[model samples]
Target chain A: MTTLLTDPATTGAHRADTTHPSVSPADAVRQTMTMAWRATLKMRRNGEQFFDVTIQPILFTAMFAFIFGGAIAGDVGSYLPLMIPGILAQTTLTACMATGVQLREDMDKGVFDRFKSLPIARIAPLAGPMVADLLRYGIAATLTFLMGLLMGYRPGGGVLGVIAGAVLAMIAGWSLAWVFAWVGTIGRSAQGVQGISMMIMFPLTFLSNAFVPVETLPGWLAAFVQVNPVSHVVSAIRDLANTGTLTAEVGWALAACAIVVAIFAPLSVAAFRRRM
Target chain B: MYAVTTSPTPPTTSAVRTEGLVKAFGGRRAVDGIDLEVFPGEIFGVLGPNGAGKTTVLRMLATLLAIDEGRAEIFGVDVRERPHVVRQLIGLTGQYASVDENLTATENLVLFGRLQGLRRADARGTAARLLDRFGLGDAASRPISQFSGGMRRRLDLAASLITRPPLIFLDEPTTGLDPRTRGQMWDTIRELVDDGATVLLTTQYLDEADQLADRIAVIDAGRKVAEGTPDELKSSVGDSSLHLLLADPTQLAAAAETVRRQLGGEPVLTPERGRITVPLERADRAADVLTALRTAGISLSSMSVQKPSLDEVFLALTGHDTHSETQETAA
Candidate 1:
């Protein structure tokens, strides 16, 4: 055989002696960040992707706060503390659903076929976009708070507490996105992924205490709401944003987020590997 | 340019070698028990009609799909057991342009370069150099959405070459190109082999295989039917064949008889359409067959003589037409 390229960057054949040295955990993380950069570029080019994150949060925060303000709580000002955090959690989680839809859409493209053929980590394709999707959650969380501030709702817990709440919600959204990313890998088509993601997302968001108090529901339903992971996230956000303090609920929400990621991360990776 | 003695890996006899490689989708074997041996620095062509599982074979070897049975090795490395090593040893450009559509051409290349383990700065440098080499310098920063099909293909190929793997898999590299672009792609592929890269390309175009491949394997229904040099294959199918569309399909049987009796050759017949393709030893011999058919009152609607199509090659090698098999698969 003829000698291959002399350039060090192109000496792929020369490195063949290193048998089965799969990409290290560190390399996988680096590759995943590179993929996230790609996803960010896609998000920048497709501005329509931000419609849900930007507009939905603003609209939901205003509409839900005013419409249910009197019925759920005493008045609009009192409801602001409870409803604003609820809106933050709701918008962030909804934005998380887009992660799966976009993943499905991206995977449907021919570029993904090339990604699959590359020598990169299998998790790179699935996790990269989810990592970048933290931005969508960030935007949603911020917009919800901004909208709340505009509507005469003040955070008693101050700037630090508000930031913490937003950060927690962003983390929760990123973690839950693993569930949808899993759906993206297993779903038959992009539309199918969106449909399944919504079916899962809507129930998780609406059945929780995002817009209404869980105690008002029947005893059995209240028990389910207490266990609902989204309720914990919303409660945790409220505790931080209104009281400016960490509570057991915040710890519970963080643990729940970690559990979701731990369970679904492997599932998403395995599904992505088996997609073809 | 010939300063070549610092090789790290042992020299192998073949660039790509596979034995009884099988891939089944559900219950149907898309690539069943196929064997291939492609030497280094040669353009090995996988020629088949649509749905012949040519892409499936490429995907399996590229580690995009799992092999259902049998063994495949790239440059002496097992494909299934160690895909990471095999991936490092080869470059795969799929049937469609595989470059990211959302990014500009330069960004896409740099992305792949970084994915190839190049640092950020080196990835940028390599992207610029590859763009210049592929004649895509002018469109380097344009988003891939603005690219022509041929340009996207070039960029896709450039992405694969970032690591300069010894073996390259190109699945129908010029299937949808204009003739001018197809010629350009053919020149590019030839350039790869000259630079010590082995290429395995698949196509449904017999003319493409003739012009490019050092050796050709003709497959049908997931099984390889014939493998030989282009000259050996052409000798069986002939240089050109007369395609006659009969006025009345019912008289096809009679027309086949007249051609056989006059030319002493077998004809490929489509009974439903009353079409007959008769291989010719020379173009001048078309007169004899036409004269014989007219005398037998087997009037023709239209006729032309041209190079043998893949269908003709299939008929000559498999003794059955490819049109029926492709229709059955409906790909």
Candidate 2:
């Protein structure tokens, strides 16, 4: 087998492991991880905002704490507990955009089409990009907590709540990737993906009471914020880190996670299947 | 993983068979209803001009695209019903280079090997051997983006070979390659065929089709126009061609008319080039032509009788030159 680089998909010998004569889910996961790892290693050379993964979350958390802390809540110290969770949600959500932008770039360069021809699982291409986005999520989550600590934002719920908050943010980032994957596949160009994704996400993030209390807004806007999934996620994290309590908002936020996975996971898989 | 299962084994017959396969995009039929059979182990060439649906046919056979209508079977397993099985038995390299540009040439091969479910050590070993076999061992560590077009193409082909399938589909594999690279690729193909792999290659280059194909199918307007061995197709056009180069430009028409009157058939003449061409069943007509031309006292620059080329056969069957833009538009 070493004498020539025969396509493994061609050999019937490998068919035993494939799921029912097609590509297996396990095989697809491995391929995606390999692709993600390759893309991850590339950051070592190209050096395009690798630090931003960690730096942006920290900067945003600190900057938002100082800017909005004193004016709205009377002092930075009093608002640090409240503002930290909101800042974490906002920064992690914003970091999700990178997945869409990178996917668009790869598609533009004909990289996805190459994946389509391989006999691996249909979902590997999505897996690779989605998995690669996790590192960004991890970096963002870590730096946010570090900066919150430096600025005197203590978690009332202790280390467990802090860990729970980070894990929640990471899971959200992973689930959100499916939505970006759908957008990247459907958009015509990488630039188009960035433009469309920004348009959709900007209002979702801004209108959902990330920076201020919903009670301060008009009656209709407050009602909208109450139902916003981002609001539930942020409030849940706030409950965990600030009050040391697992509130109903945490249940709603976990349900929202389930909903996002249900809707976007199939959407991403279907869109990918249609494309190949 | 064990190969033995309680289920009955699949029946093996023709390596690839298609019946009335049809595919349409946006109300335009790319591959009209066509039937083709590619037996195992021989190199089959699908010869056509641009937009003749050769690639579409190959794609359907490779299980990349679904058949809009009709049935396709690989090794007697229906493509739609058992596409994964078909994929397991065949290798496909599309028209463009499809390797990961960020990875080294060896990395690209190894990635595909792992995707094919090879163990890490085996995939790496296979990748190294393929890199050496394709003469890219020294360039193995360099990123694929740094490789030249020919080098990238070789790597793409090498990736497809990472698993030795019984059948291979190559869609215009040599289209943009230089003459030397194209020849090298042909040699590689010949070697694979000799090792008992069936290859179905689509090419517009008549010389390539002539050189490698055991049998050729000429498709026009998404249908097979002619199917035969290269020699058979050429011979079907006629025995030989009598080409005349006239000394005096004005005498070409006169010479053609004189030959037609004596031979009872019209001879094609080009007054601009002062040339005349006629088809002859026997070579003895060359002597008769000289006698007639001598009696007429028409001067001749050159004259010769030669066997027909695939280009001539394409012209004779299609009524237009294969290289002409109109033929491409027609398809």
Best-performing candidate as measured by DockQ: 2
Error of 1 at B95 (Å): 1.0
Candidate 2's C-alpha runs over 4 A off are: A1-25, A42-45, A49-55, A108-111, A150-152, A157-160, A243-248, B2-12, B238-314, B320-331
Which docking class does model 2 fall in?
acceptable
In candidate 1 chain B, where is summed lDDT lowest over 10 consecutive residues?
B1-10
lDDT of 1 by residue, B1-331 (tens): 1122434666555678899999887788889899999987789999998888899999989988888899998877788888887877788898888889889999999898877678888889888999999999999999999999999999999998887777899999998999999999999999988877889999989999999999999988899988999988988776787889999899998999988987888999999988999877888899988899889888899999997778888888888877766532312
Model 2 Cα lDDT, one tens digit per residue, A1-276:
122354332433333223245555666677788777766766555666356567677777778878888887899988887777777777777777778777777765534545666666777777776787777777777788889889887788898888888877777778766777788878888888888888867766777767788878999989888887788888888887776688998888888878887888778778766654
TM-score for the B chain of model 2 = 0.79
lDDT of 1: 0.86
Q: What is the TM-score of chain B alone in each candidate?
A: 0.79, 0.79
Each model's DockQ score: 0.27, 0.32
Clashes of 1: 0
